[model samples]
Target: MHLLRLRTDVAELLLSTQGAAVLGWSLDTDTGRFPLLRPARHDGNGAPDETAAFPLVPYGNRVGGNTFSFAGRDYQLVPNAGDRYRLHGDGWLSDWTVEAATDNSATVALSHTADESAPWDYLARQLVTLDGYRLTLTLSVENTGRDTLPFGLGWHPYFPLTSRTRLTAPASSVWLEGADHLPTEEVPLPANLDFRKKAPVPARWINNGFEDWNGCARIDWPERGLTLTIDTDPIFSRYVVYRPDTARDPAFAGDWFCFEPMTHTVDGFHMPGMGGLTPLRPGERLEGHIRLEALALQTGYQRATGKDYPGP
Candidate 1:
């Protein structure tokens, strides 16, 4: 496994070419050591799901029926994982090549060719950079096939979940999940599901998609004495928050959760307007960036110092 490391005085990040995934990321602050994302189970040797985070290229989430019709042509996608539907495209399952690298930044690229199994051809690139206590990831994809297709982008980042972990991301509505783990309906945010304010992630199976996000979110780990703020490009207006338990994932131990920033809704291929998936012609491209800043919560006399307060 080829792994790249980016580090600063206060933070460090590990990336692997296997899936262009973040193996692990953490911070060393005056308060303590904080694992921003869940530590990888076996470093770069593990699968993307076992890593801290991975890219969602071409599209994100599952596409219902694994088929869609665009511009009078129909396309079918094969399930890339054990899931019933094609999930997160193929970026997380394919190996990427290193395009560039430095002490604090690295870029990885992947090229996919259309086939009967999955007919979406594209070239994807991800740039991971670390500066001080902040990390930024910029992902871009270019349609390289003959037919025009709807394309999307996103990131699947897992954060350590603790008893005191809280999330705050105001969204207009949420898509309820069906038994098949696919979205079933759009409804007003429920009190238990609402996070307009800082709230604990409900301890149940949650795989809903949030809509009309303001491109910002926050995760507070009071137990770790640190907080992480997520800022994304306007192109990514939707997000999915997932919380799995032992019932859904036997290997799960309630240690982590996912707050995925996506450019389109899950199963957008079947929704009107393609759910947010942009129709791209050959040579057309789509891009987005996500920034994560880590700050140490102030103690007794520790005055606020760092980026201006990112309001909720």
Candidate 2:
């Protein structure tokens, strides 16, 4: 199926039906057009990861070894994404129905039932709206089962990673990944881990989660003379930063980086304080919003007088 397209004066967006994911978002400017999120690399037949952005619903991240104990009973999950743990959630893998669409807004819905590979029965919806230069994505999930289960919501958006791109975000702590792709321990943010000064992507591989995130981050692309700001609701207090290793995924090497605004850490079910999983009773719902604003920077002097101006 063809992806839905949305437009405004300064931006153009592509939304896919397979996962209700964002296929691509680009900014048009005087200098040149550039993608705010990484452009989609595959058709709907490929994995959600190939898209520019996708929703993290019912839960975000892995559940640890495909199993977790909740309210005295045990739940088993099937592994996804080549991991030994249950990755992402059913919403990202299932086809979503387009409930509504307009010039600058659209909504999609997905429903799931508890089965062998899935345990949580719920209904999820995503509403995407664009006003001027801001793109807002609001997501909600309501438990439909008779029993209660832990739930979380978030968004996975990949941004273009160029040589001069710098990211600035604030966080109180970080979870270092261990052998099994799970957090080994929690520690205070170190100098190297700090992004407050707009740091470049680390040369080495990084797949860690940050806790108590300030819910705001700025990504600047100097060469392109563009900047993008990301803002999320408090429900997304945790964030995951990931850049695949070249040897593992050469196709994605240095092309993009994911700054995932999530509600919990990977495999949080196995840890006490790390798990942000909220116990949702029957009929209960979890919801949140993420907004992105893209703007062009004045990297060159005034055309008439060749004079400089202040820049962000």
Candidate 3:
């Protein structure tokens, strides 16, 4: 497998052929590393670790099989886990072809064929660009299948955790999950999964999805003088928070937590009326964008460049 690395004064990001996934991104000034999406866990050397990295294409945490019925026909996908529902779509695990690369950006593309034997074909492209303290990712997926298929998109980025790390976002409700990790109910935040108050991640395990989130969220590391503000286009409405009990690992204990922005819930396919299933016509495309801006938190909300809000 080939891995591509990109670095700038502000941050460093890694891209891998397997799943054409973004594997790692870290701020240049911070001691902590931001874990990119991967399907299998691996050490820094790129060898597979027992744990899975991040899943691509269909990002965030997706459960259930990758099979769904569309237009009265049931379709099945190659399961990432044998005997289980397909997970994270097929792109993240598949090798993507690098079409272009430059000092400031790179583009990778992949195509799938639809036939009676494997009837879901599409073309996907990912573009990564670095601009000062901000990095932007844009992705597009086009259906090449003769028949329409259901789809969605998202990003899985883990941020470093610190005593001063704080998350601020406007969310109306949160999903309550059953043992299987699927949402059973959508309840108001704070009363349940709220993080607006900047509560330290509890020692107890948490793998829950939330909905009705604003298109923006912020992560502040006061001690490090770093602040990351993430803004997504309206297409991304859901977010998933995962705090794994990595205390036993020692290597990654209290290191990071994931703030996943997704287009919908884990099993949106089974939700009433297929809540998050996006349908694409022949030759049609699905596209989304995410922008991450980094700044230095000063007396109050100052840009890293020392410019004030609405500065000249």
Candidate 4:
């Protein structure tokens, strides 16, 4: 496991080449240690289920039945997880080539060719830089194929869920999960699930996608005195929040939850809005950036400090 470490006076980030995943991010503040993102689990290939967070390229989430129609042609994708749905692109599963690195920054790249395993050919890059207390990630994907293809980019970060963990990301609405754990319908934000006013993640198991995201979210761990403000570029207009129910899966016993910043909704390819899929001409590139800033919330300052990070 080759680990790349980036540190500054008040913050540190560890990135592993395995899946271009974030091993861990924390603050070395005067108050104490504050974990910003969930720690990585292993050093193998980037395993989205194990790593703290990984990049989703080409597309994110499912495609409903592993098939879709694009530009009048029908396409079929290989189901990765149990052959049910195609997963967060192949970039996370393949090792990335280190293009450049420094004391506080690293750039990794991955090249993929159209094959039976995947339908598109592309070159993807992830550039991570540490500046003081902020960790910025610039992610991009380029269509290297001969024909036009639809693509999207995103980040799958597992956030540590605490009893007092609260979330705030104003979205236009949300998608209700269907029996397959994919989205079914888009509806108004429910009172309890709506974070327009900021609210704790409900104890109940919930796996859903929010659309027209405001390009930012805040996660606060009161017990740990850690607060992470996640802001992203405009390319990403969707976000997914998932908290598994312990009874459904033994793996749900952990203290982590997912607050994925996505460029499109889950199964967006088949949805009416096409889930924000962008048609990319050959050689065209899609890029976006995300910033995760950690702070130690003081006693009297219980408020979340994430302002509306504007999008394009």
Candidate 5:
């Protein structure tokens, strides 16, 4: 499948035909990469990264392993191991059609039917735009099924590495995961998980979700002479941090890290009052926007672009 690539004067972004996923996002003026979506593996044909565009739908995480009950009826989705329900959603791997594109942005759309096996037909759209030093990504889903369905949205982006790369948020608690990676407990942020101040990712494995998160996060890359501040409208109350253990994934044996802005925790559908699961009524739509600002740390100049954002 061919991938669609979009560019502006300041940045370049890639969108895959499969799942219309974002493959790569980088600032055109700098060497830093913005969206760390992985590259397609090269077996021989020189293909793009297959797992780059992970679906964040029907639920961001598992639902007890491809099975769940809604309205007293049982629903089954494709399993992604871990005895945890279906992972991400079906859209990530599905091919998406590019509807429109321009020098500064592009829009891709995909539609799926809710059949007996997977009873959640929906229409989804993803728009990516690069304005000045800022890049914005927006996703929307419309429920086409006769019945309401649970849903959520999240973006998994890999950021360029730098000694100054650090994260800060106002999170009070984090979800404890079982061996199977399911939510086991909601514990207060321990001294290690605490990120009130800018802290380097410790030399340990982390694949946990945080709750009670404020709608703001900051990443500073001093070596690149840039600092990115991400601010989401209050709709995003949860965040996920994934730091692969170098011992396990030798490919990423360095200080690289991920800062995921999500609507809720994994399996939030089962969690209580934690922005749990989102339900979209038939013909209803779910929409959210992420605003990113890129500032020249040394020059103190900034620029931004996103939904409803004014030009720099």
Candidate 6:
């Protein structure tokens, strides 16, 4: 696995060619280096899931039953990574080729051919860049298959979750998930799940998709005196928020949670309107960007939130 390091005076990033995952991202602050995303538990060399974030190409999330009918044709996907459904598409499991790299930016590319396991032929690319206190990840995919197929893109990022961590992202509705962790129905956001205002991450298990998002979110760490703002391209109108339970996931700890910016809803393949998956003919492409800005609370936190700084 080839690992690339992109560093600047204000920020630093580590990425692995394996799955094109971001191993870590942190900001240099006067107090110390503050982690923008969850730090890899082990060395920078590890599975993509252990990294700070990874790209979701072709599509993101699951398609029920590992089967779907598109354009009057049926397609089947084999379960990957030991999951019941073909989870998160192939980008995360396939090795990516580093096309270029610089001190603060890098581009990774991937090519996949049609097969029984995944019947979509496509070419994908991800560009990661860090400027000052901002980091942007742009993912693009082109349908290289003979038949027109639905395509989507997204990013799964693990962020540091503290006891006082608060999230503020506005969404119109939420999808209720079934036992299989797939969307069962769309319903109004519940009081506990409503993040229209800054609120703590729920203590209970949460694995659901939020729709009609404004393409923006914020996470504040009062204790650390840090705040992160997440902004996405307009194409990303949906997102998923997940927190695993210890009972189901042996690796579970309260230290981290995922905020996924997706172009389509989970299980978009089977949704009535195909959720939001865009149909792409040969040579057609779909793409979007997710941008994050890390800031020290001392400068503008009190002014923006109208709350006094809770210093370190």
Model 6 scores a TM of: 0.94
lDDT of 1 by residue, 163-254 (tens): 99999998999998988888999999999989889999998888899999999999998877788999999999999999898986899998
Candidates in order have lDDT scores of 0.89, 0.83, 0.67, 0.81, 0.68, 0.89
Which candidate achieves the best TM-score against the true structure?
A: 1
Please write out the lDDT profile of model 3 over residues 175-202, one tens digit for every residue. Answer: 8877666678888885436766545555
Cα RMSDs, all models: 2.6, 3.3, 4.3, 4.4, 4.5, 3.9
Instruction: Mark the regions of model 5 whose C-alpha exceeds 4 Å error after superposition.
Output: 28-55, 81-85, 273-275, 297-312
Candidate 6 stretches with Cα past 4 Å from truth are: 298-312
| Residue range 117-159, candidate 4, lDDT tens digits | 6789999999999986678999999999988888999888888
lDDT of 4 at 185: 85
Clashing pairs in 2: none
Q: What TM-score would each prediction reach against the true structure?
A: 0.95, 0.93, 0.82, 0.91, 0.84, 0.94
The TM-score of candidate 4 is: 0.91
Residue-level lDDT tens digits of model 6 in 1-312: 798999876688999888888888987765767888888768856666888889998899888999999989988889988889999999998899999999999999999998989889999999999986789988999999899999999999999998999999999999999999999989999999999999999987999999999999999998987888899999999999999878888788888999999999999999878999999999999988888887675443344556653421
- Once superposed on the true structure, which residue ranges of model 1 sit more than 4 Å away at CA? 298-312
Instruction: Name model 2 segments beyond 4 Å from true.
Output: 298-312
lDDT of 4 at 179: 84
Candidates in descending TM-score order: 1, 6, 2, 4, 5, 3
Candidate number that wins on lDDT, 4 or 5: 4
Q: Which ten residues in a row have the lowest lDDT in candidate 3?
A: 46-55
- Candidate 2 global TM-score: 0.93
